[model samples]
Structure formats: C-alpha cells, structure tokens
Target: MAIKLLSQFLVILVVLVSLFVNNLVLASEQYKDPIVIGMSAAFTGASKNLGLELYHGSMAYINKINQSGGINGHPLVIKAYDDGYNPLPAIENTVNLVEEDEVTVLFDYVGDPTVTKILPLLKKYEAKNIMLFFPFTGAQSMRQVPYNQYVVNLRASYREETAGLVDHLLGIGHKRIAVFYQIDAYGRSGWDGVRKALEKYGLDIVAETTYRRGTEYNSSFNPQVQILQEADPDAIISIGNYQACAGFIRDARDANWDIPIANVSLVGSESLLKLLLETGRKTQRDYTQNLINSEILPSYEDLSLPAVKEYRNAINSYRGKSPITKENYTESGYNYVSFEGFLNAKLMVEILKRWTDFSDQDQLHEIVDHLNDFDLGIGVSLQFKHPEHQGLHQVYYTTVSNNKFVPLKDWRKWSK
Candidate 1:
C-alpha cells in the first residue's frame, strides 16, 4: 500500500511538471515568431510604382538579414497593406497593424493625407518599438510634431531640400525665381523653405503659382506661364510631384518660356523621367537639362562607393529571374527604401544584443531614445534624441545626365 501511494504521487508530480513545461514552450514560440514590421503603401492604383520599389527594396534587405541569421536569431517579417494613397484606408490599415497584427514597427506610405490620418493612432496605441522610416511625404506637420516619440523620418525634410535647391540656383546667379507648388501641406512646406532661403539673399519670389492634385491644369497653365514670362524669372522652382510638375514644365516650354527649372526630391524618380520622355515634348529636353535632382542616398551608378557596390550585388543576387532592367535601374528609390529599412533593422538588432531578456518595454524605449549618431556604413548615419525624432539629417545632390544620375556633391548635413 505504501509503494502504491508513492507511485500515484510521482505520477501527479510528472503531469504537473509536464503542463508547466508545455506552457513555457508555447510562450517561447509566441515570442520567437518573426518580429513583424508593418508596411503601408500604394500597392495598387497610380502610385503603385513607388510602392513596388519600396516593397522590393525593403524585402531585399529583410531577405539579406534573414540569410545572415536575422535579428538576434529571430526572423524579420514584413506585413504589407495597400492604402492606394488614400487617407481612410491608411488609417484603417494602421489600426489593423497595431491592434490585430501587433506589428513591432511601421514603414511609411506615400502622401501627407494618408500619414496624417494614421499619426494619432500610433500615439493612441503607445506602440513601444514602432518607428516610421522613409516616409514619402515631406510635410512639416509630420516632422515638427511636439512629442513625436515613435517617429523617425529618413528623408531630408522638405524645407531642407528646398533650401538646397534655392541655394544652388542662387549660386548660379539666378536672381528672379518663380515657384509652382502643389496645394497641400507638402507643397506649402517647400514654399516656406524657398521663401526662407531667398530671404537670406534679400530677394523675394517674382511669381508664385499653385495647383491642386488629381486636377488637369495643363490648359490653365497658359495664364500662369504668361505671368512668369512677364516676370522674366531666371529660374522656376517646382514643389510638387510628377504630374503637376510635368504639366507645368510642358506648358511653360510650349509658351516659349525658357529658363532654368528645378524640382524637389520627390520628382527624382524613374516614373517622372519616363513621363517626361513619353510626352515627346520639347519641354522634356529643356527640363531634363535644367532639372536639378536631390537624393538622400548615394548614387547607384557610382561604383566607386562600397555601399553602392554592395547594393548592386544584393540586387543582382536576390532578383535572379526578374532582374532589374537597365532602363529601370536608377537606384534612387530602391536605395531610399533599403537604406531606411536596413538601418531600422540594425538598430533593433543592436537593442536586442544589449538586452539579455526582451520582456521590458521601458528598457526598449529607453535604448531607442538613447540611440544617437550611430553610423551604419557608407556615409549613412542616424541621430535620435528625446526631443528630436528625425533620425537622418543629410542629403546628397545629383543630376540625371545621359540617362544616368551623376552625383554632384558629397553628402552634406542639412540645416533648418
């Protein structure tokens, strides 16, 4: 009877121990699942090209990291959703990513309207490890928020790029300048930048114009062109995306207005180049010659740089069957996505390495807050602080010549 009782007690003990072990295994599995990074982009519709480039670049980096054993032995997974460059869908996608998917970070989508709708949700959820990288929109509202705790802007701010363009024009002795900007926050930011930069030279804009997005302003450009021509500005600065800028350029040229034309970094893409070329308008040639493109990454065509070579090798190795074609291989857009995503992933990995256990959210936030002036490689560096969330503050200038973008100057730190 004593032996039988001992045997029953041992069995009960084994069962309890087994249950506890099983629960621990389950918890570990839940934690080990790929650290989810959510992406909001325009996968469909007009801005699909931008989305495709961003997705490919980000996925390429993710694949490279996973092949090398991932972030602290846990794979990084990207959960992407198409917002079609619309605000409502973007907001809905943000809610789903945070509440349902429980993503660790959020990749940016294009357009100010869409991002504006999602900002409050990010704050409301207190998504601890969440950060937005390489946002397509450069609105001041996105970058200048009072307590943007979890946001990290990758691109040079609209104001910075605009000032750079204006300074370059001023250096060339272009005194009279005309401005054409989109009628939105993004456009307004560039307008303000131009205004401030010109103030330094004691010069003011000779003529200024605005256009609404998704509207046909090609015909209406006649009066605006006449006004700019009458003003006889030595240069014209465009602060909008491809469509409106293209129309403005074409109309200006058709009206026999020949002057140096400069545009924001948003206009520095293959789509914009293709649109200009496809129109076969004389303005395309003039615009291409005079257009000054600004970039936030090293030029892919410059093989002298180690980072560019690595990026080239990555694209060649990973994209085997569907290789990036010569016609579509500018690397500006791809470099932006990869550079931002890789840096974010690297920062996360660094944080993980510093922690022996990943159970504390406060520690994670503190580490991220303390991350400042960390160099990633090939001139890409990040600086994050408690008050300032804009991680990157550098921009590179380049120009498209002979169907290739050539670097004009070395990387320069941007000033407010």
Candidate 2:
C-alpha cells in the first residue's frame, strides 16, 4: 500500500511539472517581439515642425494599432533620430538605425539632400533587406532607376506638382513664370520640372533666383525679390522652405510686387502661413496676397473623405500623448505633412497584413513589388507596380483665403 501511494504521488507531480513548462512555452510564443521601424528626420533646426508633425501623425496611428494588437501580434515600434535636416547626420542616423537598432523598416525621412545622400546606403545594406519607405521629398532621384527598387514614394513628384502649377497659370493667361529656388538637388528638381513643362509650350523661365538652404524668415530676401521684380514675370514659383519662402513673400509684399507667387508641397504650408500672418499682423500689411501652394495630399478640411475624417479623429485622440520633446513640439493642427505621415503608417500596416511572413525580410521586395490596388481610405487605390514605385500621382493646388488654404477653384483670381 505504501509503495502504491508513492507511485501515485510521483505521477501527479510529473503531470503538474509538465503543465507548468508547457504554459511557459505557450506564453513565450503568445507574446511576440516588437517590429521596429526607424526614422531619420529634422527634429531640430529649421525644419523641426515638419519632422515633429510627421512623427506625431505616424505615432497616432501606430499607437492605436499596437493597443489593438499590432500587425500579426507584433507591436510596432519607432526608433527615431534627429538629423537636423543635414545629410551627414542623416547618414550616421541611418547606419545606427540599421546596425545598432536593427529596425525592421525605415520610414518618413525628410528633405531631398538627406534622402538622396542616404539612398546609397540601402544598396550597401541590401543584405539586411533595408528599404526606404515614404520619404518626404518629391525629388526624381528616388523615383528613377538604381534607387527605385530600394525606395518607395507616397507623394506626388515635384515634376507633377510644377507641371500642374504651370498648366493652371498658363490656362489663366499668365505665361512669364520666374522661379525662386534653393541651390540644391531639391531646387534643381523643381526648376527642372518648371523648365520641362514650359518647354512643351516653347516658353522658358523669365527669371530665376537661388537661396541657400536654412535661410531664415528674419533674413533679408530683398535681393531675391529685386531679381524677380526686374524679370517682370506674371507669376513666380518658389522651391524652398517655409522660413525663406515666407520671408520672400513678406519682402515682396513690402515692395508691392505681388505678381502671384506659388510654392510646391515641400514648403510646410501651415507653418509658412502662420509666419506670414504673424508678420502681417505686426507690420499691418497683407503678405498672403496672390499666394499659391501645391499640395500632394488632399485638404484636411474635407470632411467628406474617409481619410480626412479618420485623420482628424486620430489626431484629436493622439494629441497631448505624443512622445515629442518640448523643444520640438508645435501646435500642428491638421497639417499636410502630418497627414501624409499618417497615411504612410496606415499603408505600411495594410501591406504587412497582406504579406505572408513579416519576419522574412528578404521577401519584402517581392511583396511590395507585387502589391497592387490597395486602398488606404484615401479615396484612391495605391499600387506599387514594379519600375514605378511612386504610389500617388495626384497633386492639388491651394491659395490663401480668409487666413486659410482653400482649393484653387478659379484660376482667374491670379490672372495677369
């Protein structure tokens, strides 16, 4: 009897121990490791607002997705570094993100110079399956051969934007177009776009001026304004940032040379408008007269679109909970840059869902290359057809009205 009791006790003990070990293994499998995405953007210096807003918008959706059990039970994480909108730091940040952080993907990089500089690194790190997704610039380098396989663009190119602007201006009988551009790859891209569009009509840029990167709003743009004024062009397209563009607008208005100025989506329109409004209020002058800004994303105020409504709701919920530092934070309310960032995150998640195995990075290129007609609630289907990695080609134009950017319904407002 004693021997039989001991045997029964040992059997129970073994069964209990087996159950405990099995539970531990199941728990390990249940709680998977996080999927990390890396970013290198301008969190400091002149383009700080754009960087911070983009981060905030991406996090808004990412945080929600994680809360609801992230993509395939793997939480999404972002490891970001501030490049200060410079190329060298961007390269360093890219290396750190890939080598040390070991991020699963790279997303939402800012500025043309920084992105163009970092493109070569993707080929170098091809063994790591590194891909640059949704960089902020519309420069052609990312859309063309060599880098096209490694990069994907979520916004319209500068060529599309400039062509639309030139076509509209010409439709309204404004042909003599001048260009104010930053002397860099980005500026040259826009300059090239305008030149090509005008070439189709046998027209040419009547005047052109260049500004160095990081030119501040407090800096004098009187020289640039003088050059544009002397050209006597009917309209001017500016390929530069908010501070420099706003400063030029202020000076140009102060000089009373308001012959319709247009800017591409690269300029942070909200920030530019705010700066001009503040200056105008102080100086008792209207600096926003005859101003046009081309946008890659639809207007945020459009409530009818599912994407806009979702974006507003997401931003409202994510505000005050963003991880941005105090110095980098801004009251970015319904901004285009942030909206684009939000869409970037949304589409990434969608793609991951369709991918059979997210852990297999080697298969990413094949998946993305084959992805087609995926909708992000943006009223447009996104397709990543190979040899054409650019997802969106639609460009919208806006002008200042009642202290806000409204759609350009009538081109006659700026007719010469």
Candidate 3:
C-alpha cells in the first residue's frame, strides 16, 4: 500500500510539471514574439545610399513606436537583406523572409526592376492571402490592377512625377527636353513617363542617350554627356539613380553644357547634391537654380507644415542612434528617402490599426478598398479608389539651396 501511494504521487507530479512547461512555451510564443517586417533593397553596391536612406527612415519610425511600447502589445521588428539592387539576390532574400522569417509585412523596396521582378512572388503569396505593402517605387505595376490588389502604394506614380516636371518646365517656357536613362525596366519606366508627358505638349525629346544599368556614377558618362552637349537642349531630363545622374550632371558641367538639368525623385536628391558640392564646381545657389529634382514630398528641411514638423522630430530623434540590427543606416541625417520612410511607417501603422483582424488578409484588402480619401496629416490627404492605385496625386518640386533641398514655393503655386 505504501509503495502504491508513492508511485501514484510521483505520476501526478510528473503530469503537473509537463503541463507547466507546455504552458510556459505557449505563453512565450504568444507574448514574446514580435511583429516582423522584412525588407529587401540595395544596401550595398551603387545604390547603397538610396537603400540606406529608405531603410533608415522606415526603421527610425518603427524603432520610435516600439520604444513607446509597440502596436497592440506586439513589438515591431524589421529584418533586412542587401540585394545590391539586383534581382537574383532579391528573390533569395524575399523567399527566406516569407518562408523562414515569416515577417508580417514587406515594405519600401527601392528600384523598379526589383519591384517588377518580385511581383509574381507577391501574387503567389496573395493567393495565400498575404499582401505586400507600400513598395518604394512608383512604378506602373504597383498602380495597375490585379497587381494593385496585392500592393498598397503610398506615393504618386512616376508618370505623375514626370508630368509634374514637364508641366512646370512648360510653365517656364523651357522645351527641347533631352533624356538620359539607365538601360533597364526602371530606366525605361522613367523614359516612358517623359515620353508621355512630352507627347501631351506635342513635343519630343531632342536627344536621348543610355548607359548600361548597375554602373557607378564614376563610370564613363562622357559619351552620353557629349551627345547631350551637342544637342544642347533647353533642359535635360535625367532618369536614373543619383550616382549616375549626378555623374551625368557633373560631366555635362565639365563639358560646359550649362543648360538646366531636371530629374525625377528617384535620383536621390541628397546624394546628387552631395556629389555636386563635393566636386566644388557648383555652389548651393548654382544647384538651387540650375538643377531641379521633383519630389513626392516637400523639401525635407521645410518644417512649416504639421506633418513636416512631425517628420523632423521623428527622424532627427531616432536617426542612427539605436542599437544595430540586420540592416545598417547612415547617421548622415534626414533627407527625402528617410523622411519618405518615416511617412511609410506612419501610413502602415495607421492602416494596420484599422485592420478588422490581424490575421485576416481579406479584411485588410477590404480596408484597402476603402482606404481612399484618407488624411495623412500636414493637411495632405490620400485617395486610393479602385482602378487608381496611387494614394497621393500631388508631387512637390525641389531644388538644392544652402546645401539642402529647398522647396520652390513658386512651383507649388504654379503646380496647382
């Protein structure tokens, strides 16, 4: 009888211990696990500056929120992989993020080719009810249907950006536009926007030149630069990344081709300005007057608006001061990409909070369907109605001044 009782007590104690261990694991899985976001962008190679700016900006906001206690009891974490702005590596990073890391969302990928190549994966996941949110490129794919069903864009389209530039230049009576572009889908997209914009004015590009994609700014731009110099259009519209575009401008100036240079927002305004300043041929005034870079948001330094003020505070406060993670960022301070990244985080969190249920992708889609006419502070609003994937229709024009991007206040008044 004594042996029987002792055996019985041991069995009961074992059962209780197993139950406790299981409960502890369940609790850990539930409470300690954070909400993961994965990013695949060019963190190295020629496009490093662009990638870091966007990454830093998005992470800055995310870090701020998590420090304050996170979203609905879950912390926000970002995992990033450097794809060198290439497609093959992007595919690998994305697959791992989806299947292994199991991130809750994907955000702010730079480069049109990267986004274009990844759309099929985005669709594959969408079939499983997963969505890719707020990619960085304003490519037409993100703005078109079926694909747009899976993507939720936060900015104006490349077409809209280019049109704004053409209209403003036309307003000032500068035609005879020439174009220089990278030889890729990304470059082609910008070229097309320019073509369409010029078509509206019954005009055509005076000269068009191309450079092989993925080369650095220091690459031989002399051939293209010489071509443009010979044509000598009133203004040259450069549709490429900052380094290459900056190189073209630098080379053009070297050739004494002093006509105005125009660039779409993807040109990396801060990087381009930095290159010009470092080269020492152009002063702040020289750049602010002769060179123009169109923007989706006003100059980062323009803190007059309520949203701009908030952006300033967030990026300045959080920029590069945090513990390091899978991704690295520049402490070089706030600019267009980082500010845009901060805005991306804000927009994501806002839409996410309204999600009917976190796990229901269908519900998220429903929310996106009605996400139009949304207010995003700074007195700016968004319209995301169906058949129109672009949330923001307006683009801001900027020029470098005082070593920074200064809003052309006149352009805004005229842009309207």
Candidate 4:
C-alpha cells in the first residue's frame, strides 16, 4: 500500500510540473510579442499637420525606446489609421482598431468631434478595460462624469484654456469679448467655456460667428469677419482648427480689423502661422499681428525646461526615422502640436513602466490612479487619481514674435 501511494504522488507531481512549465512558456511568448498602441487622427485633411506632427513627435520617443530595447524587452508599436478629421472615419478606424487590430491601448487621438464620437466605444468595451490615452483635443465631453473614467488626459481642458484667455484679457481691461468657432462639438466646447468664464464677471460674449468644420485655408471667411467686425468686440476668441482659424485671421487682418484675436491650442499654431505668413507675403499684410494662442504646453524654444531639451534632442535624433513615418511626411522643424505629442508619448511610457502585466487591461486605471505627484521634468508636477483623470492643469499663452510663437509675457501689449 505504501509503494502504491508513493507512485500516485509522483504522478501528481509530474502533472503539476508540466502545467507550470507550459504556463511559463506561454507567458514568455506573450512577453516577447510587441505591444501595439492604436491611433486614429487626420492625415490627409486641413488638420493633417496636427495628425502628422503628433505622430512624428510620439514616434521620436517611441523609436528611441525601441532602439535601446523597448519596455521590458517588448517593442511598442502604433497602428495608425487616418480619419481625415471627420467623425465617420474616426468611428470606422476605432472600430477596426478595437475589433480587428486588438491593440493594447488607444493613444494620441486628434480632434474633439472625432474623440467625442468614439467615447461610446469605451463603454461598449468596458469589460475589456479599454482606455484612450492623451488625445489632442481639450473638449469637456471626455473630461465630464460618464466618460471621464474611460480616458486619461495629459493636457488642460478647453474650459481651463478659455478661462486663462478670458482672465488675462479682463486683467488687461478688455471686457467686451467675442468668439469665433467651428460649427461642431469642439467649437461649442470652447464657446461654452468662454461664456462661463465671462459670466463670472457678469458679462457675456459681445458677438459670435461660426464656420463649418474642414474649411480650407483658401475658403473665404470674409462673412464671419464682417459679422464680428460689426459687433466691434474688444477681443475675439477663436475655437477651430489651423485652416479655418487661419482663414478667419487672414480675412480679419485683411479687412483691417486689428482687434485682439486669441486662439485655443488646438489651432495648430505652426500650421496657422505658415498659412498666414504665406498669405501675408502675397498681400503685404502682417496677419500674425495681434494674434495670441493659448497653449497647454510650454514653448519648444524654451531650452531651460528639461522636457523641452529632451524633446528637441529626440526630435532631431529621430525625425523621419519612426517606423510609422510615411515617405511623404516632411518635418516642419519643431512645433507645439508635435511637442505635445512627444509629451504624450513620454507620459504613456511612464504609465506603462508601472505595469508588469499587459494582459490584464483592468489594471490600467488602478495603475494610473496610483501615479501621484509624478514629475516629468516639464516644470510642473503631474498627478492622476480616481476622480481626476487629467494629469496637467497649467495653461500657457503665446503670441507670434519674430515668426515664432513665444510665451506671452506682457498682457498689456495686447490690451485694447
């Protein structure tokens, strides 16, 4: 009887050992596979610069990691699809990313309308624990109650940006403000923010005008400019993409309407400047004058910030080298949109470093929530907790100086 019991015990031990070895082998294989992050942004529309630069900026850091041996020996890759800044394509691309590509996470999405339309997918995949990381827009829809849990934001919200713009304008003694925005959720988000900010002072927007989304640089914004001119606002806050905003600015300046015009960061400052400068040269007008842009990130020209230095180094070292960079994609030196994208990649990697197991998506929120008081060397402390998903709160303002966007130091210069 003792001999028979010993043999049975040995058989059970062998079975246990076999199971353990097989599990170990499976885990090893999974770890060796590349971790893919999916992205959907405009690559062919008027907002293409935002998508392209954002992708390039992200890939600069990501490529640096991959070259040195990626996170825990697993290469990080982004499978991107162009949505052309439209809602329908964004939905299609997102669906394909979740259903077909099955990427580990979503990162660096662009545009408010696109991001807003895709928020419902997070709920649909709630069981899968899918979350979007650091999309480009600052719209409030994703930051609000129901959808906030599904997304982690790296930048300040549109509300915060508009508030800062209003505060400075008010501080400089400009009370009668106006707004020019795209006719979409994004524009409405900024408009709402401006309205709320002005309401605190018992004032409201002096006038408002709207332009359709995807309006090109060549499209005439004279009508919108005419409407705002009639209202004779002290300042105008524009909430739209680079193309539409540039068109409006060109027309406003061409019409000799020199009222202070402020744009939210989503305007893609570099792209707007490029268009306006080109038109200004042709028309012999300085369209960049009296222009101000609210930014969520510091100026790339500021080499004092550690993050900015790192960004310039990474961009110079990795431009046109990222695996996803297309042959046709040209580098536009350094710009805010891409700089924000570089920061987005840096933050994502920081979040990922805290995770040992990528298989369980449920752990993402817990991991992010625990990242408290973390510093990214960006001259500010970043925090993420259960209720608050946004990591950064600082808003910056910039205006064109010497053909580049620099930090706004004196609000009195623009005071009407």
Compare the candidates by lDDT and give the number of the best one: 4
Cα-based TM-score, every candidate: 0.78, 0.93, 0.87, 0.91
**lDDT tens per residue, model 2, 252-301:** 98998878999999999999999999998998888888999999988889
Error of 2 at 183 (Å): 1.2
Report per-prediction Cα RMSD to one decimal: 6.5, 2.3, 4.9, 6.2
Each prediction's whole-model lDDT (CA): 0.66, 0.87, 0.78, 0.88
Give the winner by lDDT: 3 or 4: 4
Off by over 4 Å in 1: 1-31, 127-130, 215-227, 281-287, 320-361, 409-416
Stretches > 4 Å off in candidate 3: 1-30, 281-289, 319-328, 411-416
Clashes of 1: 0
Residue pairs with colliding backbones in model 3 are none
State the lDDT of candidate 3 residue by residue for 257-285, as single tens digits: 77778888888888888877777653422
Model 1, 256-330: lDDT tens digits are 665767777665355566666666554345455555566666666667766566665665565521122323434
lDDT of predicted model 2:
0.87
Arrange candidates by lDDT, descending. Answer: 4, 2, 3, 1
Q: What's the true lDDT of residue 119 in model 1?
A: 77
Report lDDT (Cα) of residue 48, candidate 4.
83
Off by over 4 Å in 2: 1-30, 320-330, 358-362
Candidate 4 residue spans exceeding 4 A from truth:
1-31, 321-325
